[model samples]
Target: MNTTHPAKDLQVLAESLASVAKVTKNLDVLIFGAGLGGLAMLEVLSQSEHVSIHSIIDISEDAPAFQLAHELGVNTSTDSSAELESFRGDIIIDVTGDASLRSKLIAFKREHQVELISAKSAKLLFDMANQELRSERTIETQNSRLSLLDCMLEITLQLESRPPIHDITSRSFADIHSHVHAISGLALIFDKQSKAPQCVGAIGENAPDCSEIESCQSCNGIILDACSRLSQKERYKLFKPSIQIKCQAIENCYNVALPLWQDTRLSGVLLFDIQAPLSKEQKTTLKMASVHLNMTFKTLDHFQQLEEMAIFDALTGVFNRRKFDMQLHQEVSRIKRMKNGTLTCGFIDLDDFKQINDTYGHQTGDLVLKHIATSIESCIRDYDLCARYGGDEFVILLPSDDAMQGSCLERIGMRILEKVANFDLVNAPEIKTSVSIGLVTQSGETAHAETLLKKADEALYEAKKSGKGCLRIFADEQFHYTPSKE
Candidate 1:
């Protein structure tokens, strides 16, 4: 029920429930997890007359989800999510985020080989419900006044730009005799291996029709001349100069074409049949879509590059100081908010960096900097962030357990000493890069941001003084007025 109309969708859902009503016996719907999404479904099902809830199952007896389910006058139980699948129902909705549960459910389905020949109605209801649930979440993100005309224009622009398409097909392409309006559509894309574009994604009406790619054709009659231009050799040789006008989908059918991209390569193109001519206003949205899409591509490319660069020092393509400052602040905030998440921070300096530049040369020092950055990044987690502080100094923000009750900072300090100073460096593994770290944490009333930052710097300075390559923290936790050290 991927329908635009609320009334029609509800009716289809009701009909689906009715078809299952005969065998939908003991009609108790079971939700594996009574979290927000589960409860949302439960609310809709409660209004549906064909089914009743068996139970809302969750591991937590006190989970807020269970509480909400109970308040709705629904049956509830505190058991593992496994028990829900066994209950009688044509459809079972799984909402838990647990991966193990998913594996178990998939295994159960295979083990039982549960297949129904007449699942059309049941499947419809299931699909409709899921659509509605997901649609609810989009309440805040979209303001599009979607229409058939709008669909046509968007399709035209998509085809013109030849964008690497996600969802559309040529089979759904309808040859237009006049201005057509308000038609449901699907867009499909095909790769070099695909005979025709397969419907990978769609918005309305089209479905199961595109189980295969070869099914994507306008009719028994396709413009052969246009089709040949799609050849790799032809495409590479600016088949565009002449083929652009003739080499398109469905001469008689109304549809658009688009290319797909992966890295710098073209994966495939998509085709859309809006089934009718589009008004200029609707075409405007399509043009806007082009501009929006261009921006999206640039943003994605830039982010990919930035992420790679983030692993190094910016000036020297090594881990830069920016990452260190960020990690310190995040860990400090995490510690302030929860007892379980505590972290430590430290700053390190290359002993006599100026002397090294003067005697050994700045080039040698730069090589050392790159080696240090590599070592730090290799030691951290995907979740962990590391950066060079500046010049010859680097910083580390490490997570640690609060082993000594309130001195979480000390635990993190111990870990860093072992992780960085003790581990092998990148290039100079033997004459390794060593660091002095100042570590600190705000475990109590020291929740203010400025205090936490100041305390961390103070601890860093103490490490610089207590001989290089060592760790230190402020003796007292409440060093509120400690001056910033950066």
Candidate 2:
């Protein structure tokens, strides 16, 4: 019996080893000082699938150690002090070999419940730790990698599809928010010269409704004040024409901003609200989306420039005859589909236009034409359309609910005459001209665009017959010409 009791100590030793093994499983590690030795330790630890490297707290973002950690899908930051303050870990490894860093970690250990391991100590225990912590988490990590790749490819393909600029931006914001679990997000583009921001897209309830938000100075004031208070380093960051605006306190939420640039010009700002600070991978993803958004805006702007050149009059900056023809046809079709409305057309001819050019130089004639264009444009309602029909001729279209009323047309005609008469062209003192305007209203559903134009032209011919500087109508109630008093 005494001989059998002698081996009882071996059984007690086995129980102690099992307890240590249980504690080594599923470690959450926060490694400090991403230097040479630190990266070596990271590579060694990364092999143990049960050990999740939560983050690396390092001041040197460009260090090889930091790069390796990020490539391995670990979160990283330069805010060592802030990170250390909140991080709770099963293991905090210090491989910097710096006395001060070790001292800081030792101090941290006293206030927090963490197992602090130095480089020398890690070397002695790493193998045992790895063996004890082995698990199937390697599969999960691979799945995460595949998921990230899928997201990247999906967004790139969507951007390549060339949707409308606004739709592209809106979809991008929505995708970013969904992936990052953000509360809200917004994208804004500003005019290069005016710096006046236009909100291209918004997502979620907390996202800024730009029209409503910009109207409230209190909300927009915070953003403006931040721009004014930028430091030298902050401004330098923006010198690249882009900066990540971190406004954690502005709206009491975590916000990330990346300034978008097309070449050297500042195109706009892309922003989102994150529940927590963004990881390195998240920032890379955000930047990728922004680059595509910039490209989309450029494509849209180019098309818009081309469209304006095609549809707008070169000299008067109003609609050209071709565009007018298309719009008139569209209006006539609209009138046919509607239950009740009067489509009124007015033809304007400059009185003695040929004589004016013959008396003055052609340049002065051009000036008169410009004056008339400006006056007519100012008198019409925003919804009304006007166009330069021909040389010394203009056409205006007014859609009203009733055909019997021509009061709006009369008022508009009077205003055009008053403005042109009062205008003082310093270069041409002898330039004086009046407009003979003819109006025709069409209410029949079968009315054609050309018919309205022909009637208006005939009325204008009648006005010329009576005398110069008069308004006439080709409706049931005819308008008589009244000569203007000098």
Best-matching candidate per TM-score:
2
* TM per prediction: 0.41, 0.59
Q: List the residue pairs that clash in candidate 2.
A: none
**lDDT (Cα atoms) of all candidates against the true structure:** 0.50, 0.67
Candidate 1 per-residue C-alpha lDDT over 48-89 given as tens digits, one digit per residue, 9 for 90 to 100: 666676677777677556766777788777654445445545
lDDT of 2 by residue, 1-486 (tens): 224332343443344334435777677878877777677677778877777888887778786778888788888888878878778767787766677888888898788857676655554445444444443444544454466556645655664454554555555666666655556666666566865556777676655456764455554454444334333222111222322333321242325665555545665555566655556556555555555555556665666777888888878888888888888888888887776777888888888899988987788888888888888889888878888998999988887655546666666777776776765778767667788888888885745898999889998888777776677776654664545423
Deviation (Å) of 157 in candidate 1: 18
> Cα deviation of 452 in candidate 2 (Å)?
0.8
In model 2, where is the ten-residue run with the lowest total lDDT?
232-241
Model 1 lDDT on a 0 to 1 scale:
0.50
Q: Which stretches of candidate 1 lie over 4 Å from their true place?
A: 1-200, 203-256, 260-269, 273-292, 299-334, 339-343, 398-432, 475-486
- Looking at candidate 1, what is the lDDT of residue 329? 68
Give the 10-residue window scoring lowest on summed lDDT in candidate 1.
171-180
As a whole number from 0 to 100, the lDDT of residue 2 in candidate 1 is 27
